[model samples]
Target: MEKKIFENLSKICKTINYIDDESDIIKYSKDWRRRVNEKALCVVFPKNENEISKILKFCFDNELKVIPQGGNTNLVASASPSKEKEEIIINLEKMNQIHHIDTINKCVVVDSGVVVDDLNSNLEKKDFLFPLEMASTGSSQVGGVISTNAGGINVLHYGSVRNNLLALDVVLSNGEILRLGSKVGKDNTGYNLKDLFCGSEGTLGIITKATLKIYPKSQNYFTFMASFENLKNIINFYEFISQQIRFPITGFEMIPQISFDLCIKHKFMKKSFFQETKNYYALVKIQLHHLDEAIIDLLEEKLSECSNLYSEIIIAQNEKQNKEFWKFREDLTEAQKLEGKLIGFDVSIPLDKLDYFFTEGKKYIDDILKDIKFHTFGHLGDCNIHYNLIEPDNLKNNFYDYEIKIKHVVNKLIKNVTGSISAEHGIGLLKRDDFLKTKKNLEIELMRSIKRVMDPKGILNQNKIFRN
Candidate 1:
């Protein structure tokens, strides 16, 4: 049956695009986290929208499952395959292309497979930026970012992928093309279909191309790193700066001492920079079109007001220092891998409850799990925390035994605070059950109804977003 299906796919897709080698299948089967690994029958790379349409049409007609993958950098297992080995992976790397960039309209139309950093590099030459950035920008693709509705440091200023997205060209389940939204913006014609698919996680359709909003590059940026003795002080400082400073704050990130220590231990950064580390740290960046004496004076006044709240404050005087501060945050993920087994959580709560959530969540984990360390950090401006659990050296090999209990303890506490279990990270195979547990019955039913309407045969990204 697998051989016959491959033959049919070959007729619609190019021979070079069809890949069934075990090595290639193994590479594309797992996600970035390596949490789930499922073998695939084959991986197909379609070069154009027409090819993708034909492939989807064939899969729908044959009742074969298709997992549309871009970059394969998803933290969740959304882009990974299933355990049955019946699904075929549709890799979109070959379809990468920047169709056009309209500076006057402030939008860029490009193929789905374009890397986030590559697009930003092109836009930088024109003094423009896409504004949706994350740690995985170097490896993540535009389509996957849109599908996941990714949020990053700048979300406090520019918002998530959904905000920057102006339009999308998607291939539906039955090979039908859907052009949603508009390049000119401000369209109230009918139901907003673009939003329905923006974070749909490929359950509704496959995004082939997109029109994204861009903004003029900021001419001046003020970056600073401050250390606090406690999380409450950091929270207080965040609220104070947010209210007092009138300039555009582009980045506001929180990094705990443990995360910083891990990075330093792994040699991701020099320890001499952080001469005296505090309990927690906050990184802030403000972007402006122009910087004047008045702007500088106002920023200085604001920082002085919260001087007592922070123990140490270091402002980036040049571009090199600014990049070094950001490197501290971006290297946290890779640094954690150097430690033992890691279980990471991407969740969001009310802005005011940021300190409380971390305090209580850490306490809950400490009580249940022994010799476990917590490395918590995220976009504190938006209340999203990447609360991760790391196994101790003695218990490194036995971390899996406590995975379920740890998740339960953490998720239950988050629920108590009325927080979302899955924030920017979509409810891929990793968190499907957790999502169902947290969401209301009506909400789940509505989602299922929409899924049925868009994919009746259940061939597109099967068993994702929701459970069977």
Candidate 2:
């Protein structure tokens, strides 16, 4: 069966584009987390939508499971293959192309394989910006980001990929193509199908192209880091800043002391802003067409009023300094790897309940676990935090023994606060069971119905979002 499928795939794709070697299959088998060790029968790269349609039609006819992949940077094992090795990986890296940029519409039409950073670079020349920002922008492709509905530091202002996405061109399970939404902003047409595929994680269909909204590049940026004595103070200051800052604030993030320590220990950053670290730190960024004395004075006055809340503050003087401050926030995930084995949770709570969730969640973990360290940070403007646990040196080898219990305690706390277990990261293989348990029965049924309607054969990204 596998031989016949490969033979047909070869007839459609070029020789160089079809790969079945163990080395190549292994390369595209695992995700960024390196946790799953699943291999594929073969990997094929389609150059255009017509080729993708043909491949899907073949897979549908044969009832072969297919895994649609882009950039392979998913942390939740969404793009990884199954351990049974029954699936074929459809990689979209070769289909990268910027089809058109309509300045009049303030949107860019692009192929799914276009890297986020590369698109931003191209837009920079024309003074336009694709506002979907993520730490993995360098390796994350447009289709992958859209499928996952990625959110980052800029989500506070520009929103996530779902917000920036205006239209989509998707290839469904039966090889039929769907062009959803439109280039124009206003269209009260039928069901908003574009959103169904935005965060679908390749379960319902494969996103082949997209039209995304763009914004004019900011003329000036003000980046600063502020230290708070406690989490409450940090929350209070954020509310105050959100109310006072007249200009558009592009980014807002919170970093706990443990994350800073890990960065320093790993040599990710050399300079430390404070002589003594505080309980929490907030990174704020504001965008403006011009910076003047009045705006500076108003900002200082606002900070003076909140002096009791913050212990110290430092604003970037130049672009280099701005990047330096951001490096501290962006390098955290990698820095934690140098410490020990880690378990991470991407969650979101109401803005007002942010401090309560952290305070209670930390206490719950501390009560049950011994010798476990916590490194917490994320987009505070939006209420998402990457609450992570680091395994101690003595228990590094045995961390998996306590994985289920820890997740249960943490997820219980999240549910208590009415928060989502998976925020920016989609429910890939990692959180599928948790999602099934936590989500309402009707909601789950609706999702299952949609999945069945789109992929009746259950051949598109099988065993994802739900177990087969």
Candidate 3:
């Protein structure tokens, strides 16, 4: 935050609005989870890629650092300013625009700053959908989600942001504009350089625009909540239902009974028809291209084939109830937060070892950690679990040492199962230590080499993936 840089930024961003107020700058520096709040020199709101290119070039020339921001709703603080280095944030909110929607290819080209829900709402008019469903859809921007390769409810059907993306327009550290891939359905050209920036976590470059695949909107939908008697039964049921269903399931969330009760306690939902007392609940959703009320009866008949897996099941009577059920599952994180201190772990397990990850992981936590609730919930179809360890009421708020031990042991378990430490949430400042310690030496080195090549001066999002 030198006076020279401040004056230069003021002159350079004369066309755009750069926040000079201390309070406003501090707000831009914070993570959405309110986990980290660090100092930022200033926040520059750019209108388009040209403005961003100019800002990045100036910062690069002066050896100054800059963090690219969009929506600022990341869970892992991937878009937050640095804690160790002085950096400026280039907010992309003003660059919001839906450039094109190709009717033939069924794709939409949009700026990085377009809100996810807003884009989907626009697409819905044309009987199309972006199909990225998440709790933060209303606030999360395209650039932010694509950068983190965000996986949400539709990932089971539509895949991650990386899978849906067809092309990208990015700005590198030295102000060079690199457009990777194209608007084509598939391009088996040389290396897919676009994939490198999809989940780069803002360390290498900034995504300015993206062309993503869109699906035809499904008016016919069915949602149901089934309560399982045991942990093994839930996994068994997921495998069984996935194979039995004709259409790809849009969402298959696994929320434990405790989480469901907590959501009720916090009034995340008024009530649920699926109020059977059980250990686990599977909130399954299916989208049918053709409207058929008989499908519900058919699904019930199929459920009878595996009645041993659960105690009860309730299908939504209408669309309103169906949405309410999904809301209950989405509000789980907030409900858990209201209860006590929550430590989040987004890990992916193989479909076969998912049951083991839960049973064995709980055993380890119970043996060493002693007093904590091992709350589990996530997309069962894709095998991504949001495994959370919560400090319950009556427990003294001293779990710092316990947290260190928990991550160490849990990471080992994930490594053993050939699962990734990061499933959807990319490795940002929060998971940097675990990533460095658990990742292979060669893998880390390769990433470091790539980092060097992309931003040799290490000015872009410094001290993020690797501590420089």
Residues 1-468 of candidate 3 have per-residue lDDT tens digits of 466676776665642223446767767788876778687777777788998898899988988888888888888888787663378888889989999988798889999999999999999999999989999889999999999999998899889999999999999999999999887867887899999998898889989999999988888887888888787898899889889978778899988877877788898866555655777889999888676768778887888999999888888888988888887877888888788777789999997888788888888888776768778888888989999888856877575557787888889999989998899988888889989988999999999999999998998988777997
Estimate TM-scores for all models: 0.97, 0.97, 0.96
Which RMSD does model 1 reach against the true structure? 1.6
Candidate 2's displacement at residue 20, Å, is 5.0
| Candidate whose lDDT is highest | 2
Tell me the spans in candidate 1 whose CA falls farther than 4 Å from its real position: 14-20
The residue ranges of model 2 lying beyond 4 angstroms of the native Cα positions read 14-20
How many backbone overlaps does candidate 1 show? 0
Instruction: Compare candidates 1 and 3 on lDDT and give the better one.
Output: 1
Residue 4 accuracy (lDDT) in model 3: 69
Better of 1 and 2 by lDDT: 2
lDDT of each: 0.86, 0.87, 0.85
- Per-residue lDDT tens digits for candidate 2, residues 1-468, read 666777899888842212446777788887787778878778888999999999999999989899999999887889887655788889999989999888889999999999999999999999999997778999999999999999988998999999899999999999999999889888888889899999999999999999999998886888899998888999899889899878788899999888888888899977577877798999999987788888788888888998899999998988988988887777888899789878888999877787778788778777767678888888988989888888876764577677888889878878888999988999888888889988999999999999999999999887789987
**Which residue pairs in candidate 3 have backbone atoms (N, alpha carbon, C) closer than 3 angstroms, thus clashing?**
none
Candidate 2, residue 387: how far the Cα is off, in Å: 0.8
**Candidate 3: deviation at residue 2, Å?**
2.4
